[model samples]
Target: MGRMDDRSVIVTGAGRGIGRAIAERLAAEGAAVAVTDVDEDTATGTAAEIGGKAVGIHADVTDPGSVRAMVQRAREEFGRIDGLVNNAGWDKIGPFVDSDPADWDRIIRINLYGVLHTSQAVVPVMIAQGGGTVVNIASDAARVGSSGEAVYSAAKGGVISFTKTLAREVARHGINANCVCPGPTDTPLFSSLFEGNDRLRDALVKAIPFRRLARPDDLAATVAFFASPDATYLTGQTVSVSGGLSMV
Candidate 1:
């Protein structure tokens, strides 16, 4: 049997990139997955690709009402809530002082507030079900402070702190909370940050210790480990899956 046989999981932004990889990995491990995205078509497409144990739900994680509905839909379709992967995030690349306030607000709403909304909506279900896991997809920028990623890093930094506090608060209830910090990765979601410029991408990749950009599967594997039984004893920590890019 697979590691997550019969388990129910929710993976946000699962229409593509790392989120899609995570959803696919969990499904391969026998989990019934609820794949969520703001774009309904891609979300459903991903669910179909993963097989019958998955369903697609369209949601805006930045909106509390939408998140509540997403959680409810997951419970209704899967019968239980075993895990939540907060992998949906947004950002704009620029110096901290150079960024517009509006950009900061937009990034924070999706990157930080979205975590809050989803976790709050799902925790009650997880608690009643006896236990659950939360894996927030943070960024290496949160740890090492990347240039041009000030707000994004700050928002993810808050998520790291939030992971620890939430873990402490819910350990008694059997819920695990943690984060995975990915380095510069090759995901469609990252397209915006690089502006579709191959030269810039090459420069970024050369800087990494691995001499290549991280793939979505790399992030997915790390997240899968966190959700697996092997990680039951682990909580409140951040695993840097950055190919030794940010070792601090």
Candidate 2:
């Protein structure tokens, strides 16, 4: 049996990239996974690809109603939610001084408020069920700050703080909340940010002690650990999977 045998997990933005990797890992570890995404096709497609006790639900993380519906759907399919991975996020690259407030609003909505919406809808279920684990995907940018990602960093920093506070409040209910911060990951989002800028990508790779960008699986493994029985005693903590790029 896998580490997550018989557990049920909901992973947001699970159509591609890191989210997809997390879903795949959880499913492989014997967890029934709810793979949610804004795009219905991609969500269902990913669920089909994972091929197990996995279901896909379309959910807009930025919307409370949508998040609630997604949670309801997961509960209907899996009977109970034993884990939640808030992995949905978006970002745009530009100097903070040059960034538009609208963009900042969008970033905050997806990266920070999304976490709030999901946790609010799902935590009560966990409490009712006696226990659950929350693995929030924050960012190394939030911990160390990154150029051209000021607003994203601020939003993710709020996630880290919110997660810690949630952990404290929900520990009495047997809920564990923690944050995972990934750095310079090799995903479509990362590629989009550095399109035609190979020099910057190369420089970043050289800067990391690992001499490479973090694979989605790297982040996935850590998230799985958080969701598994291995992390029952861990809560209100933030882990950085940055290949030694940020050591704080």
Candidate 1 stretches with Cα past 4 Å from truth are none
For every candidate in turn, the CA RMSD to the true structure comes to 1.1, 0.5
Q: Give the winner by lDDT.
A: 2
Q: Give the TM-score of candidate 1.
A: 0.97
Candidate 1 lowest-lDDT run of ten: 188-197
Q: Give the Cα RMSD of candidate 2.
A: 0.5
Tell me the tens digit of each residue's lDDT in model 1 across 131-246: 99999988899998988889899999999999999999999999999999999888876777788688988888888888988899999999999988779989998999888887
Clashing pairs in 2: none
Candidate 2's residue-wise lDDT over 169-224, tens digit each?
99999899999999999999999999999999999999999999999999999999
The true-versus-predicted C-alpha distance at residue 134 of model 2, in Å, is 0.4
Question: Clashes in model 1: which pairs?
Answer: none
